[model samples]
Target: MSGYSGTDCQIPSVPSSFAPGHGEGLEDKGCGNGTWTSVEQLVAVPVRPFTFTEAPQTITAGGQYGVLEYHGSISKPHHPGEAEFYLLRGVLTENEAAQLLATCSQALSEAIGSGKGRDLDVDGRPRFAVEVAELGVLDGKGSALRPLVETVLLPLVRQKYGQTAALSSACFRRFVPEERRFIPPHQEYDSFAVMTIALQESASYTGGFFLQGSGKAFVDRKFLQLGRGDLCIFQYDLCHGVDVQEGSHLELVLHFKDSPQAVADGSCPWYSKMVEVGDPDGLFGHALSLVKKDFPAAKEFVEKACEQDHVEALYTAAEWFWDSPFGLEESQNSSASVELWRRAAELGHCRSRSRLGSLLMQGVPGRLQQDIWEGKRLLRLAFEQDDPDAAFHLGQALLQDGDRDGVTKLLAACAKGHPRACFQVAELYREGQFQFPKDLRQSVRYTKWAAHQGDAQALSNLGHLLINGMGVVKDEAKAVRLFRHAAKLGAAEGMLNYGLALLRGSGGVKVDYQEALEWAQKSAALGHSLAHQQCLGGSFRD
Candidate 1:
């Protein structure tokens, strides 16, 4: 075929296969060959068997012209899948590679350094590395090749090998002189394959040998050096890494397999050992890794646990997936947890219903929101089912919505045995906020009840009442005891109040200037503005 000049590269001026004006602007003018004429129509043309030595063929048929460099292909051993690689040539420079590597490495390093990555790990240990693929997406380069690789090349590989295929990348410091030796030695996982191709040549320096797993004896020592257009394919369950002898840089295009069952099975050889040893984070890090690796089967397995007949199993699954510190976008898995809890709730799991209701009420962005009405309804159901926490939440919701009658009913039920409910009832009665009578006597009654149950807030409230003689005779000694009790419960507000009482000698008590100053300072540190100002000499004087 004769090469076409720049002007000749344009579309034909006159339509040759169809009537000149008949198919104008018709999105898909069907040709007799069953092919659509529109540029938007994707027709999967079978790729011709082009070897590495053959002239580079346009994988994207009927498209623009560009330089291409071929990388070798790999055929699946027991499967029919095959993977090939090619470099779409452009003016990519070493500086760009270095900058991208440095930026990605720094970000990963910072993430690991800041405890975020550690928090993401179940055991709170650092990962080998955080591999972020799809850098092209973040860079805004719009690599059309990604889709081509995913849709066409990946499917072709899977079809040829009879196993699934995946594509991913990782940021590493292979180019950094000091960090070159830290490259992964070699490792393998089951029923998986990997193919990596260098996007740019690194003959300028050294190192980066793509070695295959030889045997159990000496895994890390095996090495193979590959050039720009060379492709390295191996089983997923093998150990391998580039032994960078001396290279300025090497940017790779990577393809691998993402096992659906691996998610549920947690069978990744690389991480299974970590899970077995009960690594510091328990199953958390491994589970998160499975999620990150897109092990759909593992995800299904976890989901299945939520669907179990046992309430405990369902609750466990929900909590496990929901609280997983791994920052997998909440929108992705939170809905699954929500659905699980909803199912459990429907099955008369009161605790599950309460949990689901709370999640719904707090609404995660792009997931659910805090629906006060729904939360109240769910909490009411749970309360009817005799769940104390549900009663507390129902009463709280009612109080917030100014539902005086509902709040009174729920709070009364909750206060029957629940100390928290007693405190709430006392607060409502004291403030008369939810249409309750401002009965200081009843407030003191419930506050005393809650205080007996060891509630710090209740004790503090009771102390205030006693000192001010609001519902009882002013008793400085009694108020001091209550304040001290609440302060002992680690209540910051209680500490501040107790300090103030000690300092000013309130309730017919003597004023100790030094003690008052110390307490005021403590309260101020706890964000008590009045106490803070008092410490600064802004006190009530005789």
Candidate 2:
């Protein structure tokens, strides 16, 4: 389900072939002068597609200096939200592209080609020749490519979806040749429509062709033979992927969704517009801009903005300070950060209160002075305010103290989809620790919930259970896949488990001593004790 329907609305089959670009093949379903007795009847009433046409010149004349082709779906109930795509042919001059490439390449060097602990595919090879995190480069105010999306891409989406669609994700993807380069077909989630812009000439890549799949067989297939600026749009639910053969390829993907509104009195408003219209100095706007960039500067900016008594800035600053590596100074004394959290908590920020409580439980003795009683009190207050984090932390504390009330609190948090609480509940069920009953099936179920939220430990633990047939049928291949995914998320334990699997040739994984050794070394570097021993001991024979 989408926000449109709680129950599964019928997903219609893709028409064999429709107009390729723009609103060329829309049928007018005239329901003129029809009276509807209820909202349901009104929805059932057919509507005609509004008149729309190709407006490349109009778009270009609006200070959009680019040579690109655009294809858009008509805004109608029949269409699955605003779907549009652009081909980036000469939209960016060579000089401009080169400049952007250089700037981003330099800015994101660490993230590029730096697979610190990513796992190999089943073939024991890297997934891509190069997979750059180009989003990091474009997230800041300094990014040259920001305007291309904010100025051009967003406006095009608004033209099709009206002004209510907000940009969900704008991603720049680069694919290069590798031993196994083709992407497996997959479906997208959390978005209504996806628009992809080709950034490279077809000749640059070999055999890497985009195909639209109906989650099974291919409905339509197209090679990269289209010109660079050729654009494609598809409903997010439609399965799509590229068959990579050789050379390099680059693309820009824009995901759109209906903007969530704070005040949904049936009249929807763009979330960004609400922010812009509320604060006089656009304080939230400035805070958002800073938060999107380097974390250190973002912290400083939020701190300065908080001086103006901006609640959002106070909460944002507290959050940035609470997150490790981003907020923690090298000295590791979080007294100053804790004070910020306390200040935000004093200002009635529920999340900040919860965060402050959690930090206080750590007993970080400093300017704020750790007090267990005060921490628990704040946790109770925050929990009463219906803060999920507060419930999770308080539940954990209570459980540690052998209090049964923690079980109810944890279940409440789990019901709300709190990943940590789900993981905790899963652990309790697995071990029958504290007040939980021993149930491996329940463990697997809750672990799955946590894993889906990207909990690395849950993924790794679930892999173990899957391979051992603890609560489910044994699936060695699935276990290996889960371990690989968990390892890719920088889980040291996942790396060690995956390495051991390679060493023993378990989970259908072929024995590759060199690869196993590499994974062992990586896990050891991340402070996994067993991996350290595995790295030191020459037990695996090549």
Candidate 3:
């Protein structure tokens, strides 16, 4: 493990090698030679502890460096809103920033391994900027992130918002200069608040970190110039985005949701404090905490918030009574669910309106009276606001009425990667149903889209097409792979097809008759009649 005797440390920004419990000599990278050991996590510390940045007012200190809240503006206010985000300077030392950056790089590499989370072009995401992997990855357990989140970040949240929250997820965002990556102004639809730390110096990148006016705030549009070891904090309610014009920008972003489990006792004084101070949102958060713990008391809390006209709570309360958890209908009161949704819909809650309208149109048995006219009206209102589910539901209703416009609406939802919508359009194209003018190519295209979004049926169907060279060029090898994946996803047809493939050793796969029998048995058990016929009728791949 012998390495460098250098007194100066420049904090290398690249990640350490993935191998654990060993030192890799990094003389070539030249931030001052050192071995990266597990002891330092991602840090390749020099022989001695050395300070990097001087002082920006030392309110926070850990041995050598001081972290202070930056009171000055990060960017000039361009829009009509107050600054939605604030910064803390000197939050990490050069070595620590390097460590954090490495951790983020490795985690993102693992989670986003040649895969995409969002459907392409669905959210207007630039192909280059859409590295949206599922956050927290759960398997990683945020172990590498615990010290940073629990110790460094959550304390800042408590200090800033007076709200008790915990880490729900974390994601890595790397804006590559070669890819010309950048993010435009948009509020996060996913998290309650966001904490992002710059893993590199401000000079490491250019033209990034800007905020815009959103919600009730009169915040001016401003850009932040963060140095190494700096922290930026804000609620997702605040409109913000990033812009990177030059070098690569590595950001370790953490999303925190209001969780009572953030505290050991599953309770927090700040929630009550906010509630007592008349913030209904606090009561809503508390109710969610109770619901997460399956405490029946959550029901009363949610109802109380609904009484205060809390829009979100009203919508949730309806759901609470409408559907039983995991089919335990004993707790469900569809009648009560309809009442709450009716109230929320009257207040212009889009989802509530859509749900209530669908229930009314279908006539929920022994619950909602049939009211198709009012139902369609409410659905149309929500759809006019571009609610995708509303379009899908209304399309279904209209399709039952033999309306051509129904397919058009379904097409709109399909474009948004709605699986049912995609599957319906695929079927229409395949069978010329509903005057869709049978286009097998369109069928294949839509089926591919559905499969990419993880539709098991579409996956099996695509495999079927590949096997027969229908619409798409035949590739039995690829087809078999798709069948295997689909079968793993629990598609009964996929199991049947995969079993046949295995029995015949099709597409370079070794023959495994035993495994084939297993898959055939599974598919037959799942009620795939064709599966039963295939094995019994001697329909092997050959």
Candidate 4:
């Protein structure tokens, strides 16, 4: 343990935290007196956990995200109908908000006289931009405002980009009654999305109008009604700013992103100072904290660190070169990558051992020579260390070669919520494939679990089963909604099924022939065979 100058093996290399989307609901309890009693789980909060809900099938304003309307209808010609921002009312209590504002206003008050922090004249006003990181240690305690922002931003980012937003940045802002008293419509390029929270009562400020707009002149405006302790979050692309008049107005501005590359590489001086002190873990962390945002800087830093005999960086670099962003790419023909993994594996990097073992067992042509015995040995070592990837690869290989022990390995991966392994095992149980007896209950369990991760195929499959009353109870309406969601995610089968459901009114939903036809066409374009019949204007059949 002393010799290994890398991450401790006891901790998991991957993030395993997950919370399902649910709203607070009540159920009536039956009483002996033939009456019903209702009870509630009360919540008193600094910030309330937002209730996760999906938009029902309807053509109207604001489905999931808040309404970002173009014309009267939500549908814009260029992009799919999705709002850029939403409102969360009463995230904090007035007292809690006062605590936040007191910090910001106090910092602003200090910045006005003292020659600390960067100086700037925002909109011709004598203002200062003092970062929260500097004031974080004011009372020798930095409130976890960034983590709080991340918790709220995570689900929204996933809904927008189909992935997680892992990092966040924040600052405090104040608007006073003097001067023009507002920043005009402008967007910050430095963030994926921005969370603008009202730290004081709307009654306190006369004209603190938060507006979002687009175009050169910025004419079309959506003036949002953000009250005290309320949050108005919008994407970076949306042009937004606020105006305040006749009173003191304060706000907590926060930024979120899928990657912390910018934050790590000197965007925030506080974080930069922490990572600049030399550690491959920082570089490796940036690589893992990304999915949709294909940042080259993360790859550059991690790969560079690996060349310096950096243990953690080499493990990440191997993953980057070999099969990055969820092991979807195995065709990369870089022998240097394998060698890097080998070096890391020899140095007691557990994940490197897992990855290199999978590759060496199969052997990339002209890149790696097959050595199944050694590969299995390495995988066993990693599996003994409880690496999920090792468990999957080892289990899949063994199962394919007619070994019952492989199922245990696949189940091991499934236990860690590995979606692919879950899908594999689910399909096996459903079809009775690879010596697994057909177990609809087990199949449904795994399929539903994988679908929760927003896998398009898993969603489509689960919908199919739900509609057919296979494994689970019949819920055609719910299944149709799943199809619609999966279709939006570019699943061909989902598109086909959703089109059919819409056309036939299978879900007790309103029939829209035009929309059904459009979905059918999309499915057909994506090579769904069933869609061709409908797209060709033939008789409807599934």
| Order by lDDT, highest first | 3, 4, 2, 1
Model 1 lDDT on a 0 to 1 scale: 0.48
What's model 1's lDDT at 276?
65
Model 2 TM-score is 0.48
- lDDT by residue (1-542, candidate 1, tens digit) is 00001110111122232333433332343443422221113121111222355565443311223434344444321123443433333323344444544554566566644433222111121232334453212222224234445554455456434454444433232333322222333333333455554444645545454432221212213333444433444554334444333434444434344554442343444445645664422233344456656645445444543433434345546765677535555534666677677776776666677777756656677667767667767777775544556666666655455443345444434323356666766665665543345677767776776665567777777777777777788886787777777777755556667777756666555777666556556656766556566556656333
lDDT assessment of candidate 4: 0.57
Residues 1-542 of candidate 3: C-alpha lDDT, one tens digit per residue: 00011101111122233122234433443313232111112211011111223334556533334566654322211222333456788767687777766765665655444554333332344232223223333234345556656566777776666556666556556666323233434555345567877777878766467654322111334567777777778764455666554577777677665554543344434466756765666676667667756647777777777888776678787887777544657778887787888887777666677788888888966777899999999888776644556777888778777554565567655533456566667776666554345678878877776665566777778878887788888998888888888899898878887887888888789999889888988988987777777667766434
Stretches > 4 Å off in candidate 3: 1-168, 173-192, 196-233, 236-253, 256-269, 276-279, 361-372, 431-442, 468-478, 484-492, 502-542
Q: Give one digit per residue, the lDDT tens place, for model 2 in 298-403.
A: 4555566577655546655655554544535552435556666677677655556787897777675453567778888888877765455777888877766655
State every prediction's TM-score relative to the real structure. Answer: 0.37, 0.48, 0.58, 0.44
The list of candidate 4 runs beyond 4 A from truth reads 1-304, 319-333, 359-378, 432-437, 488-492, 508-542
lDDT of 4 by residue, 1-542 (tens): 00011101111111122111222111221233321121111111111122325442221221223422221111111112433556666665567677777766677667643534323432222233456743122221126354444445355444554364534556676664221244544445345566677877777755464443222112233455567777666664454555443466677776665455444542322224425765444444444344245546667767756756666577657656765654556535477688888898776566678878998789878768889888898898877655557887898778656554566677666654455566667776666544455678877887876665455777788888878787789898888888888889888878878878877888887877888788888878876656776577653433
Q: Which stretches of candidate 2 lie over 4 Å from their true place?
A: 1-281, 292-301, 321-333, 364-369, 490-492, 518-542
> Could you tell me how far off, in angstroms, the CA of residue 65 lies in candidate 4 after the best superposition?
44
Model 4 has how many clashing residue pairs?
0
lDDT, residue 475, model 4: 92
What is residue 382's positional error in candidate 2, in angstroms?
1.7
Q: Assess each prediction's global lDDT (C-alpha) against the native.
A: 0.48, 0.54, 0.61, 0.57
